[model samples]
Target: MAEVKLFGFWGSPFSSRVQMALKLKGVSYEYIEEDLPNKSPSLLKYNPIHKKIPVLLHKEKPIAESLVILEYIDETWEGYSIMPEDPYERAMVRFWVKFLDEKFLGAAWKACWGEGKEQEKAMEDAQEVLTTLENELKGKKFFGGDNIGLVDIAANFIAFWVGVIQDVVGINLIEEDTFPTLFKWSEEFLSCEVVKGCLPPKDKLSAFLLARKEAITEAAKSIVYK
Candidate 1:
């Protein structure tokens, strides 16, 4: 058995974050694909509370949560540095990661999936976050300046999945004209060799998201009738 094992869902940006981190650090591990709806015994055993995927098992010790797993990967392995060595810069990375996960992503999700007034409000909130990120990227190639770091890893959804989902839903939030800097960053980030290797194929991802969207639409129609 491999010393390191990862339980992840293929279409999940969160799971891809851990994969990117492990690749960046040049760590060898076993990949365990999990069907989230029907989670495996190991995934349940490791993350009893959340019962979500992207769990990391290192030498029989399990770590849950993608962000937490990221830190663990950075600390446990030795090669490329995932987190900054500078104290203040590290703090900034953490702050941005929190903002992305807690504030920005929620708005982005609603903008893509929500209906009517709710989606409009979410678009406004998501745009504000995108503008902030565009300004932050003004003088840097990535959130980590030249290298891909914690914050960059954390923003996987914005960098890749957001565009795919927007296409599926026919909404344009992170376009070149609207947010040039962020759009450029997304292009660059997605072009990176490490990132390319880990991401699910675009066609497959789009199909998966489209199916989910259709289900939601049907469910909403049923609710309206009842």
Candidate 2:
């Protein structure tokens, strides 16, 4: 049996992050597709607390949470460390990763589900997050200096999902003029051979988001009718 196993949802950015890290590190693993709405017994067994996807099982030991799994992967794989050797540089990367996880992710999700005024506010908030990120990227090719690193991986989830949310919500927060650095980073990040090859198809992701939106809207309407 393969020593590594991954349980993930195809359209989940969290899952994508772990998958990308595993691939970049050249680790071979068994991939299991979990039905999130009806999560499999194995997935539940592996991640009892969160019951979430992107669970990485290494040598039969399970690791939950994408960022935590990323660190584990880097430490396990000796070559091509995703984090910097310098203590200060590594701290900077961790700082950005925490910022994106706590702040940007929620704002992006809010932008997706919000309506008229709420959505406008969400967009404004998302733009502010992007603006902050753009400023951080000034004179830097990647979030962790010249090469892609942990912060880049953590932030990439927002970049991918935010684009999908923008299409579904009919609003664009990462415009060229507003967030040029981030906008360019998105293109570059997605263009990497590993990411480009691994990404879920755009049409498929769009359909999934549209269906989710419709379900939410219908549920709201049903509540109003009731």
Model number with the top TM-score: 1
lDDT of 1 by residue, 176-224 (tens): 9988888888889999999999899999999998888967544433221
Those runs of model 1 whose alpha carbons end farther than 4 Å from true positions after fitting are: 216-226
- Worst ten-residue run, lDDT, model 1? 217-226
Best by lDDT: 1
Worst 10 residues of 2 by lDDT: 217-226
Candidate 1 has an lDDT of 0.88
What's the TM-score of each model vs. the native?
A: 0.94, 0.92
Candidate 1: give the clashing pairs. Answer: none
